[model samples]
Target chain A: MTTSFPMNAGDVPYSYSKNSHLQREVLDGAKEMMKEVIIEHLDIKNMLSSSNKFYIIDLGCSIGPNTFNSMQHVVQVVKDKYHDNILEFQVFFNDHVNNDFNTLFRSLPVDRSYYASGVPGSFHGRLFPSRSIHVAHCSSAIHWLSKTPKELLDEKSSSWNKGLINYIGASNIEVMNAYVAQFEKDMEMFFNARAEEIVPGGMMVLISPQLSEHLLKFFGSSLLDLVNEGKLDESLVNSFNVPVYFPSIEDMTKVVEKNDCFSIERVELTHPKSKLVDEADAKTLMINLRAVLEGLFINHFGSKIAKEAFTRTILKSDEVSAWMKINYKKACQLFIALKRK
Target chain B: MTTSFPMNAGDVPYSYSKNSHLQREVLDGAKEMMKEVIIEHLDIKNMLSSSNKFYIIDLGCSIGPNTFNSMQHVVQVVKDKYHDNILEFQVFFNDHVNNDFNTLFRSLPVDRSYYASGVPGSFHGRLFPSRSIHVAHCSSAIHWLSKTPKELLDEKSSSWNKGLINYIGASNIEVMNAYVAQFEKDMEMFFNARAEEIVPGGMMVLISPQLSEHLLKFFGSSLLDLVNEGKLDESLVNSFNVPVYFPSIEDMTKVVEKNDCFSIERVELTHPKSKLVDEADAKTLMINLRAVLEGLFINHFGSKIAKEAFTRTILKSDEVSAWMKINYKKACQLFIALKRK
Candidate 1:
């Protein structure tokens, strides 16, 4: 039996396609930002002399319909800049080993100009050769940690994030600090690895989830409330912390400065177009959230219990629907373009 | 319902692993020849100056145990030559879409140094971007034509190879010339495309089969002889031409000169190890032949008829065993190293 779905095209149960609207919005915004960044800061003369192969990598490129657009945009920008000097584009798409590459290949655009290949592995480590990539883009993937921090699991630690799967509405200061510390370690590693891989003057554009330090209205934390009511196992909730964090722009800027290999070009905070939604949209969000979290839940508590927990939680919630209608710009996104120093 | 087996690792029915021994021998010889060609003809200083990402392509890389070895050899040579420079290797593996990429990836050695990616397509047309490749290699491929020449199919054409699946033992001069015309066209396209893709001073090494201009002792033509005996349809034999032809060194050199983009550095003819085998060994050869030809046969005839034809042809052949023992080196192999002009 498989623990995880291929998270690719055609696999309806665990595909990213359902939630890809969020990704698409992020891509469009990121592409526009990338063009502006290239126009202002990119060293075209240096690139013309040293680079014959214009290399771009999609750091967590899940099967396309969206990643293809991201690649096309990058290729178009590079081609526009260097039309006189004949440059070839080489694009690498990266995701976990389990991601559906076959589906991705089948969905490749008929008029694709760049030579594309999939690189299977996590992006939190060294995936390419030193000084090989000219540009790297990751849309809505870097928030995922390599693993859940060990302190979150420790019963003795003061920073133990017990009975919580995420730090969305953590009242405990210690638990919040622990999640922040884990994010720091993960971000440092990500930056250092990419520092070695990306050429000097090459840029990386990252679009990630961010939460306002103001009053937090957790979108998916209602599921955990069911566990608190003894409808589900409390220990299951306590042990099952997600390896994801919503870092502030300040948090990221500091991480970038500490790493010291990259200089920030621009950072912008934006919300997806459909940030605030009605009841029907709220229902769709719940379904999408359930699909994303189901594999982990099933692995921990078996399919039957996990299914019941989700169904009851969503069905019982008037709060989730109400929360969805509120300005979800409160839960924001950050687009950061960093140049290797 | 699948028309062709995924020519992969463990799928015993259609995997290329069995016949890969022939490919391995060709690869070993080619590697030695590549070292010499690089040392003598290659301007190492020019390569070191203009290229940083030393790109190599295996044009017809079938699922490995062999292709991996070929990649390692090329990467090793390049790394050895430029030990001082921080040069990175990017190797591309090309094969038909049906080739088993999963098996190839799985078989990739854990200690591999070069960044590897698979390019899925036929080598008959443009696969890579212009001026991207430094070295390209193909082991025991390129004899396979892009398609059967159209003139062979015409009823009124004197070049009609009636009841013959290939040019082997053809009595009609027009039929022979038709095969030659198709080969010339195919070779020109192949060279011209590569010339565009490869850097000006880059290299391509091809290991291909070459047949003597003598009365052909067809290696696997007994299956067609069954049609001659009225056991199978004669039109079936006539229409079913293998998209493969063995050209002499002169034929290749002439085509290369006509293409006018490459200078021939070295061309040698050598046979694979253990080319001659007894009845037991001959059975393995027959099975290997069947695996290679199964897709074509199934496409022409139904799977049932194709299966039956193969079973009867091999089982009934004592002559095949005798033919195999008679110094099969008469059907020679060509190793050509061409420098891009």
Candidate 2:
């Protein structure tokens, strides 16, 4: 294939090979939503006597636990609804063809009730025939940018906040805005396609990271005390790239409703309480933050200062510790269910 | 449910029912095209292998021996494709809710591969779920209007001629145009909604009676000559209220493609030749003509004259005889397919 596209900041030391941890977290999230959405949508008891076939698809699926967890419920629901109706099920696990499907499929559950396959293209919308699916399962993947958004690269972009200064060597707000724009665009395509493809009454449940505008303002007011103390190298933090694009529940609802294909059936947001926490969980939380700032750190003092800066920042952030303690317990998560109109 | 509107048109008999035999004959003519279009467009091989679930719907499915025969192939291809996979299928045999499906399903072959059900709804493309069908099939159903096209009614509003001049009645061009306009409008809604429901790669095959623009000057043009010869009731014929939309292949292609959801794949037209001499078959072939002319002769001079008039009309015209002979052997039919783009 011709490579006409210019390279951008993508791929990392972890890459697809090391993304199993993400999958595990996503699987846990899916398990939680099935009870909330699928049972209520299907009216399982009423349908038990009929042998209507049912299906679920995990769109933008990464490897591991999500594929396993979603398939389990998809299969379970089919069995529950049509135990006597000669029900047969197929669980579609889809993502970009370039993703590590080998690892994903290897980790998939081999239940007789579930079968998985790769769609071999971008998952911009629903990919099955009409009225053929009962549920749609997605987690942690929609936030990834479909492509880098434009308008974010210009230093003078409207998204830029003049008063908001970058700490050390860091990207301006424009860069971050571009990534988010990309996320929004991709999600538009994904949701619109899904609207056309989902059964008239089927449900789609999604879980993804989100950054509330309220929290962003609170942070801007001076949440990063570590950066003032040289405890955290804002430079290092800026260099790291966290591919996830977190949108507030309100923003997500707008995207889902754009095409009149979906009605937001439910929404849940979890925010932790305590503002401080200890180091171990802090590392887990800061991993994404660190990656974004890594570039700036290397640009500043090269790799040595960047590595040192990461440790220094954590040691100094008492407030982050407190916030993490509360947030971890609070379960900083956002969920929404959209049904075909 | 509360009735928001008044019910109308029930007491009125659908004048177009007079052409039911013609509808059957036209559809019969297109069997091969219908089969090929359904088989290729439905793409059961892909549907079965990719998912363990399947769905199919046939709209305007009359006493559907043809639908059953074609579906037999669909079921077989699907079964063969998914023999290694855990496959399940749900098929909905749909037509006008009042269509004699009791007989249709009786003929449906025993296929262990699928669970079948009856779906009763008008095929304005509104019955099934969005993005839920693996395959949807419609044959010979679209050309029949939901009710008589209004233009064909006699001055007393007693007769409705839908471009069809009954052998005993006159035809009004204006009345026929009115019916044609309604046909165009109704079909727009039908194809648009169908487009929205099919999955990105799903298939839709439509086989219906069509008047080919290509054949119009050559074949359809000659029918008017019979009008001059008094064999066809040009005035009473204009009073025929049957809704006939003989959309050319290009016309259907344009409609399906405009929605932007479907990609036109293949199209074909089949012509049914009149059969060799057989009393029962001949009677069926002439049923509609007989019904219409009988009304005129009986009204003018009772049953005896009606018989005499019908016999004289049939015996006098060698062209009518030739047409009857050719049509008895074969009927003209058209097939079209539009897959999700």
Candidate 3:
């Protein structure tokens, strides 16, 4: 079975809260777009007339500082739209049950404009009561598939992704198709749940990373190096597969259309400029990647092997860093806005 | 400032979850009364007509197995009352910002009847949208004053509780008055916040321990012993005051009447039978008391002195346990239910 865990939690040196600069950059780039979409499509008058309180849910909100910023921005946008009306905003910050909610709640902004609550669960299932949420926001999340596709793990299947951690740079069409199929199923579940939770006129804004082959290639090569040196087993590498899928614009559109619960208002692919461009050294890149993937690696290959692989990945940082610089210029992030019908 | 930390978190050997059998007994005794009050006074028809959703807030809900059980019983009672109606229950489990919400959320029942959310905040202030909640339940909490009475800390003040941690059975009327004054202010804030949150016909049920002089006397004398032995300073005991108060029935009624928000439906003093009568040994008593008071002790007198004090207390448990056995027979718990006008 494919397993999903939360990002490295708390504000320790390697925690997701400390190492999520890449996610912050994406959020910064999407802020204007989010504001624009709310202005163009949000049914503010209807929402206010229905209730004096506005409910916003942040699905996949990991231990924050970023989730706090994102939710604050969304509340601000809504507040600006209803400047004359007095409205109370209650934001629900949601994540996996195992997320470090103690850290999240403790570090909450003391002067926040909205009442905050944390809902812990997978977003691929029902979380809130039907027609309860006014707006749903998910960012830097949902690229994670619910689990690894079973077809890729079956020995008799042509889709078995042997010697590869992900389908990013794999030449095998069957492996890539397996990943795509899993993404489709996960998106359908996500949309169906959101459809039930969000009010009919409510909106959903999602921002997730598109595929980046160089990073996965570097990760796979690092593991292969350990195998070649007789420090790791080839069978272990064959059995491991990353439970992340970066869907294309077409793939997302098809899934949304199939659900028929939300009308896609806007879709864009943009290469968000990194604010830490000058500081994006090899060590910094490795820390960022490790912050997101360390738990997954430890769960699959054990901490000792995970540590060794990361050390090896950093040793070849010069080549990886150059490739990342080139890859940074491509459109590598997807933003989509949908309105519940 | 009177620092309020959470209960000893997680399910460790010394955690509150393992040591809260006394609280469990109180909850069990209050269950029948709670159901009777709901049936007699709950404006269920008005609530159901106003909205299909029912909201319940468990104020000061620490990490749980008790909380899960309490909330489930509440849901069952409501469901039994409205068997033919389709109603949705959403329970908000609230505690201090420093509470172990990570453990609470992870340990939630797999087959819960309500949508669960963790609200991290003090219940003495507003934690929900105004006029949104249907029922508010607080058990074995709220005897905690928002802070220790400032007068008790001032050496010049006549109310200064010198060499004593609490006002239980204290000969000084001024020290007792100081505690009563703090409880009055805290109850005012608590009722005002809950009055705004609870809908016009909503209900609130509160269960708190009444004054038990033997327990606090044992605790005070234990610390005094440390001072006599020169292991602790007398001045530290003079400055330290426990932030808890076990209000008499008259104290609670006066505060509720002064608030002028809710009409008191029932007020009863109960002596819950202990199911652990056979297990009420010296070590068991120490563990139970330690689980609830360890954080408080550690906060006031460093962990070293706290350990020394508890060791001394347990050494004299034979006398203390006898006192506890008698104290257990008297009415030691207060149950009050109120309905919003």
Best by TM-score: 3
Best by lDDT: 3
Candidate with more favorable, higher lDDT: 1 or 2: 1
Backbone clash total for model 3 is 0
The estimated TM-scores of all candidates read 0.85, 0.41, 0.97
- Share of real contacts kept by model 1? 0.28
Candidate 3 per-residue C-alpha lDDT over B44-145 given as tens digits, one digit per residue, 9 for 90 to 100: 788656457788999989988889988999999989988987888899999999888998998999999999999999888889888778999999888888
| lDDT tens digits, residue span A1-341, model 1 | 11233343454754666556556666775677788888788875675475477788998787777899989998898778667867788888887656666666657786989887777666777777777788999987777767777778788888677766767666778877877887898788899999988988888999885532221233234446666677677676677676677777898899999999999999988765544232235555555556556666677778877777667656734666665456465656798999999
Pull out the clashing pairs in model 3: none
Task: For model 3 chain A, give the 10-residue run with minimal summed lDDT.
Answer: A274-283
DockQ of structure 1: 0.34
- Candidate 3 per-residue lDDT, tens place, A1-341, comes to 43667889888888999998778877888999999999899987875565688899999899888999999999999889879878888999998898899999999998999998999888998898877899999998988888988778777899988888999767889999999888998888899899988888999999986533347678899999999999999989988888888877898899999999999999999877765544446567667778889899999899999999888887887887677667666536899999999
For each candidate, the alpha-carbon lDDT, in order, equals 0.71, 0.52, 0.85
* Ordering by TM-score: 3, 1, 2
Q: Go through the candidates in order and give each one's DockQ.
A: 0.34, 0.01, 0.81
Question: Which CAPRI level is candidate 3?
Answer: high
Report how far residue A168 has shifted in candidate 1, in Å.
3.5
